[model samples]
Target: MNNKPVGRAPNFTNACIVMFGVNITWVLVVIWSLWGLLAAVFLGLGVNHLIERGRVWAAARQAASIRRGKRF
Candidate 1:
């Protein structure tokens, strides 16, 4: 299984549906849409940071785990 995160883009899509389908839910929909955008920006930053240093980080962590004789 792939463990990569897909993040929060779906909330915006849900917001669009709610905005068109039910006027009463528009406020909630807007909140969800904003939340999705915030989550996406953070997710993008995190992934970029990880991609830039992931190999080195992963290798170091793996070595530490092996040295400690930890098993998954």
Candidate 2:
């Protein structure tokens, strides 16, 4: 019995990458299958928040431009 690490029998990097890909795919499938409704709700909330923030930012910029008397 030898304790030296073999140079070839196992390709660690390939195995790791393959396993990671499968894991990610499985996670995506599970999410799509089981949590799509919840995911959509969250997605909607995120988009709403982003739109509201953009609106607020635009309003603020317009107010600033008016105060400055031109586009700054």
Candidate 3:
């Protein structure tokens, strides 16, 4: 088998963006007493993290299946 790399690079860029958003959200919502928006931001972050993990898991599974010459 060839030594081609599998999958894409690490998701540090998105992580950084998410962290920046959280910081800004915390600053604005805390000062303005907008607790609802803060909660929404955290919930959205949770969903985003889940989706990212799911994509990575799916890609890993697909890569493994490809290596084994089976249908993913």
lDDT of 1 by residue, 1-71 (tens): 99999886555877886675575345445755878766656655675687779888888888899899995
TM-scores of the models, in the given order? Answer: 0.29, 0.49, 0.49
Q: What is the alpha-carbon lDDT of model 2 when measured against the actual structure? A: 0.78
Residue-level lDDT tens digits of model 3 in 32-66: 56566667677667767998999999999999999
* Cα lDDT of model 2 by residue, 1-59, tens digit: 89988786665998897997797567666766787857756655676699899999999
Q: Candidate 3: count the clashes.
A: 0
Residue 30 displacement in candidate 3 (angstroms): 19
* C-alpha local distance difference test of each model: 0.69, 0.78, 0.81
How should the candidates be ordered by TM-score, best one leading? 2, 3, 1
Could you tally the backbone clashes for each prediction? 0, 0, 0
